[model samples]
Target: MNCLIIDDEPLAIDIIAAHCAHHSDIKVIDTCCMAMEAFQALHQYEIDLIFLDINMPVVSGLNFLKSLKEPPAVILTTAYPDYALEGYELNVVDYLLKPISLERFNMAIDKVRQRLALPKPAVADTASVRNLSAAQSGPVKNFIFIKSNGKLVKLDFSDIHYIEGMKDYLKIYTHDKVHVIHQTMKNMEEQLPESLFRRVHKSYIIALNAIKQIDGNCIETEKGGVPLSSTYRDALLKTIEK
Candidate 1:
């Protein structure tokens, strides 16, 4: 994928570029010190991914992302971890805390590759159906692998109470802890078997077996109540009735 690095720090840009060099599939098209320059680069090149810093002169990276009608995949690079939620809400591919390690940077790039592999919604039929069927009937996947703290962590599927989407990542709540992973909601939804999980909101997919009750537009799980959107409520009800 053609990539862009947008950061005011020369060292930061160089670090990212060096990481990209390790991967043959990724190429650094250009580096911009400010958002405006990055904006111009976006118009000039068919950029597929971006390593963006949250703070920059004149125009912040977030504002520049907001300005795009159809933005390329973005991985936010910032020193502060506080902006993670906001960055995810913007549909970024991943959030990388500054002074990023090669391992962490590689993990973020893996997410970008996965996103690029996904077919657009309009043409996603064949792959979606195949993945759903495999998930449901292919030797029950009791566990799933999630990237956390620069490594792959395995969690039992049954241990999950619910999953909340924060743009490009998922907050997976379990009985004992919450695991945050860089992934899109749609991608996660498809990987989960429909027999055990249900998408109840634009941002949530719950493990049906973990649900205790349904009240109004919410599902009560052992962890807590998760909102059920009007768009997905009826389908969830229909699934339960079956």
Candidate 2:
């Protein structure tokens, strides 16, 4: 994989480059200290992977990933374990905490290689699109079965207002109830329809029919007004305007 390291620490970058050199398949294309530098490199080069750091001066790793229209597979390298769960929620390939060992690094790279080996799925995700459209096309009995805290909860599609993303869990907001599930927002996003649900933030997704109001940097869904993320502000506006 042709990779780039977006980290402020020079030593960290050097170490990562050294470790990656041991593997013939992984190549360090360039090293950047900030998002802009990486952004420029992205335009200049055909990079396949990004070794991003969570804690940076201005734009963090997560925020950068959120900004991309087509993000490459990322492997987060950070000192903070607390953000590991959150990183996974973004569907990053791997999370390697600081003081990375060769074995651990190898394991993470192997996982990425395995994913790269998988066959590419077809573009026809239309069957799912039609089902979701049918739900709102008319008064259809639309619902989804979700695994909550300890049991399976069947929630009507219209009952949900939006979802809140916690580290490794999600808070689902129904008409009069909020249920927390030990699953990532990305997992829930895959099951929910894009027509009814839109990911308005890195940490939020809202049902189009349940929004009461939309304020700058926030949303007033049926559950309550939740803060909107700057990372997804533009995307949400585009989706809601239509």
lDDT of 1 by residue, 1-242 (tens): 88899998664664576566556567678899998898889989999999999988899889988898899999999878988888989999999986677678878888887899932223235555444344433455566666677675777778889999997778999999998876667656645667788999999999989889999988998899999899998898898888
Clashing pairs in 1: none
Q: How does each model score on lDDT?
A: 0.80, 0.76
Q: In model 1, where do residues sit more than 4 Å from their true spots?
A: 118-242
Q: Write the per-residue lDDT of candidate 2 for residues 117-201, one digit (tens) a residue.
A: 8332233355644443343234443666665664657788888888899977788888788898665565566556677888878
- By TM-score, how accurate is candidate 2? 0.48
TM-scores of the candidates in the order shown: 0.49, 0.48
Predicted structure with the largest lDDT when compared to the true one: 1
